[model samples]
Target: MTAQVQSAYAALRPADVVLSPDDLGGARATRHSFSRSLVRRAVAGGWDITLGRADLDEHGCGVVVFDVSAEGHRWSFVAFSQTIDESDREDRVVASSWDVTAALVDGAVDDDDVARLRPEVIRQEQGRADERTLIWTRANRSGRFFEYVVDRLADGAQPEPGVFGLSPYLLRSTAFYSNGKFGLADFERFEHGHPFAVPYRAHMLSAWLLRELGYELAERCAAARSETAVRLDGDWRRYFGLGNATGLGMVPYVVNHPEVLDAWIRLRELPLADVVARTVDRTGPDVPRVRTLLERAARYLAEQGDTEPTPYTSGAKLAAGLRPIQDLLTEYATYGTMGGAIEAQPWQHLHEAAAAAGSEVRGVVASVLTELADDLDDVVEASLTCQERRDIDPKMRCGELRGLIDADYDWLREFDFTDPTQTERFWYSSANNEEPRRAYAGVDPGERVQHAVDVARAVHALSLDLAGAEAATSVGEFLLGHPWHRGAVARVQSVRDLEYAELHANLLAGDFLPLHVQRLQLAVYGMDNYNPQSTDWLRVTLFSGAPRVADLVDGTADDDWSFTPQPSEADERTYA
Candidate 1:
């Protein structure tokens, strides 16, 4: 709202290109990512998270509780751990059992609360909870890594850091359910005047707790096996993160909540623009900081190597692309030192160079630039409570509606709805759990009950109808004559000012990759090491380099944990 903020918004990349699926898919986590911001807030608020209870046997089957106190507010994370057969450990929403189930409660958990939550948390969707519970979630142990860590610790040694080459997680969370799902507290209760008022703060915090719990479970199981077993090395402990497997369930959220999506993209883009603009005029402190961030990113990417090859670019390829950009930055630093005069926006030149390399490289550069913005926390926190309204202006003339579509929805023309492939897919909810699923239109029987995620098709249909209507006809009158176009009209009108609201691609298209949408949402949540298992679902790690429980309690947490590199061999020696 300030002049400076307005200038920053003005500098954002053109909406058409940034909002495209290709660009959004390449987005990486930055300091402003929800998970990173949540950790920063915890550190600033002097939050204390400590283990409250541990009642597990050598097999790590029992209940554990963690008490959390933040800014005089109390909460508890009650976890129920149980050993499960490998075949029973599934990440799908339809899965019946898991290695661990937990809930984040609104108040301090007591004996009665744990006893009451135990049965419900384990039962997942089949169970129920009261309004006091904020989140209900479950995780499965990361098969080989979990066992390797426990075995190494039990032998009074440390697992080699190379063991985490594939993933730096001990457990993979299947889902985190909240917002009145199965009777948990609705978002309205804590959306305001609560410590976790920021949209996904509670969810991210729960994920952090899950990561901590994974470490505890590993240590407990190891200690039970040997008298010499010791706690995991501090660095290794922080290196571990909570894993997550997300599928089609998130695609609809991306489609249905354009306002929320726009806010997230705008917040990230605006800060990046501001950083570039401010730094273009000078080689200030941020110049070196940007270089340092780039170095970290390159190293992290190199360490991660190539993930399972899918349609997306691999980390190794991204690392190779970054090499030239790194050299270019070093050259820029030399020019600044040699007292070179202003040419044509050196920062813009650098960005252009990155773009030429690849879309993923461009995103990496943009994410790094965001780290240099002064208003990151301010912008992110202010945008936390979305004020977007999808209400239609029924009084507006049909001509105006058509004009808005012509200007903003021009991208809709790119798709040919007549082509069977463009309309091949339809999204629907599963009857068993109401989980979102996409199916081939004719091949799948759910087309009759399909969800309305076909924004492109809707806009095309609406435009065709508008062509025949009188120019001065009001949208209300137009909708009254053709009620089928109501949702499309409202959607087109509501996003008139929200440039990044709608994805430019047709979700129903046969070649449309849902993983791109998933990656975008996960990047916003600060997830790392995106390993695509298939086109529709993927595995990601959250809070991988974030502070451990000890750091939060000791007030040593910082926000420089993004783009975490792999731990070196020397790090493992500390435990030995």
Candidate 2:
């Protein structure tokens, strides 16, 4: 699909399809009813799963080096599996030892690389960056399934895929490092495309590299147990996947990037709305394909067990709920869904069907849009661009400025994030390598040094200040008047056009937790294995492992190495 088709699809505004005023959840304040956040999160995570296979193709193992030929330097993540006292293991930001320790290897090295990386990767992760490495980090098996699967696999068996599910806490404990987050290379090497325009690709390189090292250890354990120099063959799913313990630090993205967030939601929602809006196949056989997609989504989600708020089952249940909407869509109501305004408008009918679905189905049907479009993933990836370039448009009239401020503050002020229901914790990156974490407002650790980058509150403040200021104030003038909120003002003033980006919360309020902000970000960018327990560490993947020499040799550039299929012709549609 071309970028033109993608953009044309995304440009469908709320006004184009909305029936009543049911835009933002309901009220004008809640008008952001179009939820791009959840759709984007699912798309990013799903994309990574597919990308993981590609990484596997690159490395011959279950991980692979991405498209990195422009810079031929081989950077591999050398992972080590050292059994530590389980009783002593912890998910705190300050814990020094983990079930695994990994380091990025620059080019092929002799004996010197192994000796240097072992102690250096371990201790420098204890906060020593002078190891002369590009990236260094470690992760505990966030799931007991790691040990369980190893036990099962060692007994000569393959564990079920369900063993690889993610938990919010484990999800919270995951982290990644760039440059020197834990004393590796400075981030500058990755800013341009050379070694890192591809962010997750680089970090996965490290994780996959480490996983290969685990194969060495597993081979050793197998040899000692069975009494031979046991060479291992076949891929092991039980021991794969990086473990991350996450917390509120990384769960807030669903609400923050409202516009970019909108892009993700819209892609999913628009397509879903389109599909449901279609005639229900009075004589067509395509209905089953749609139902099959829904079933696949439901089954995949069910495999995840559950998670709070938005449980894994929610996605499946969402699919089930839409079946009724499909039924409703079959026989047209006597009165048109939109009364008469958009009697023939398919998108408008979609809005009416969702509105009749109540809020729960409303949200669910809204989400089905993700599976409708051919280029949903592309729309999702496009949303990952940060609104760092957003500028405060100074051209708006003073009246508009005052109203936007008033409206923003009133909507955001409703949530008492400090209250148990509202503000349950605080978020911070621990000094122990800067991994993300969450603790009681006063207990966890660093409550004083909070990273309060919540855009909703910041934007609200900017609006209110602008509203109360002199009539002729430009956004720059307002920023100059209050320099502290400049970063936020820049974001708000510039990103007003992006409807799905803001989370409508005060990150500075006593209830604010930065981990939620971080998770929200990780989910949006699709960075898995980010441990929230390590507040200072942002666990990300790099080049994964090296791609298979066989595939590259066979001239099949389209190989999905993670789970490579039998060699085939060089089709031009490679999934990089």
Candidate 3:
């Protein structure tokens, strides 16, 4: 379709660009402290699973199923679980009997269809590529939350949120799937009619569907206990969200899809920089907006369930700094004013004050402010296109070779490879090339046989060699003399900003650490950030609190792919 057709294809319209990091940081101050990063911040804070809303945990079953429709467009989740031996239910890709395995079908399965497919879906490999399928997935139960919810609900009671002592709302976080990974809809299905618009927010949508499907499975299994066990009430049905755990595998995707990632990161960065840069008073329109934002954020923080909440000292510092700012602004402010007076850039002032207080709340504050700026297709619409398709002009001058690398990136050489700690860590793919495995120094077979694709070090080393190369030669010609950097040279030339992409530390050195490399990639992908010094920590957030298939019918307006609050006829509360 033409660009015009695509723009107006379904229901594309202009809306706010999206929250920026500065605004996000300011918003964070309204509630918590810590050098809040736009791309990095605490969310979902816990593993609580409730349906529809955070409250009403008593009726939760940690499982939900989607009801299928006929147009070949509808989808459903079929989750399976049995009291399997924990040893048999490992989370590895090779495990045969996972605690949960699911598949999406072309059409709704009646009792007969469901019965037949149950065995087939359980046969994950057998159904791995059924064309009509959009997504297929599984998760080993928390072993704790799974059994706890079942026991309590089976006994006609809600699971107390204390068996594990996490926030009551965060009990059911585990695993989920999305897209047409196995037998679900092809990614194209989501593109059809922009059906996924608004209600479809990536893998989380599927997880939410799985949550409902999980509830159904639990209800069916529990029906043997009592027919009354089924929660048929509207309120009972409207509670529950799914929790997911992802890992290092997600890091690469952010690097790969720069546009989408950039949309999120750039919007965050640009906005926060904008808000924090301002240095004015609180007499303008933003004062009240910030006040309301403070109220909501505080409410959100209170409502927040901390399987792990932002640290208290951090939270206190943020709160301590922000209240005074808000108070001052409110005292000097008028209602409904737009920007603060010429000198009263209240929003910007908040950033400055926080900065003085050593508050790094700018990230979350950016998110809050992003919600305020009423225009942002540019921010949210940033597309992720790979720019690594350049053909290296291997003919540049030798002097030019060293010049570009140093100027573009202050490439410098300083590392001792003989140190075991530096080169201690190694990355190798599984025999299948799917999972990435890390090994300690001197232990892994692929240590000396490692991939020489370390862009930064390679570039720096190339720079040093180029400087020493016979002069009066072009970079392309220099490559003829020193072909070792062929790969590095091509890569450096293609990527717009190589410095932003590579880890500064030398992996070959005894002090080489992979945690920062992993963290940076994860942060870029919008994945939750953590210090995974062990490389074993890998969890991602998907389908946590989003809409399901039903919303596709009822939710007409479209902005982002999120849940729309059903509007009352009087108020016309649209989700978009």
Estimate TM-scores for all models: 0.96, 0.61, 0.65
Residues 507-573, candidate 1, lDDT per residue (tens digit)? 9998998988888888889997888888888888998988888787676777888788877776676
RMSD of each: 2.1, 9.9, 9.7
The residue ranges of model 1 lying beyond 4 angstroms of the native Cα positions read 191-193, 280-283, 306-308, 337-345, 387-390, 432-434, 574-576
Between candidates 1 and 3, the lDDT winner: 1
Clashing pairs in 1: none
Weakest lDDT window of 10 consecutive positions for candidate 1? 336-345
Candidate 2's C-alpha runs over 4 A off are: 1-73, 127-133, 160-173, 180-183, 186-195, 208-224, 227-240, 251-289, 302-410, 413-450, 453-468, 473-491, 508-522, 525-576
Candidate 2 structure quality by residue, lDDT tens digits, 208-293: 44444444344344333433232422333222433444444444444333555555445334454444445433334443433444
The C-alpha lDDT values of all candidates are 0.84, 0.43, 0.43
Candidate 1 achieves a global lDDT of: 0.84
Question: Per-residue lDDT for 54 in model 1?
Answer: 93
Q: Which prediction has the highest TM-score against the true structure?
A: 1
- Ranked by lDDT, the better of candidates 1 and 2 is 1
Model 2 has an lDDT value of 0.43
Please state the error at residue 336 of candidate 3 in Å.
12
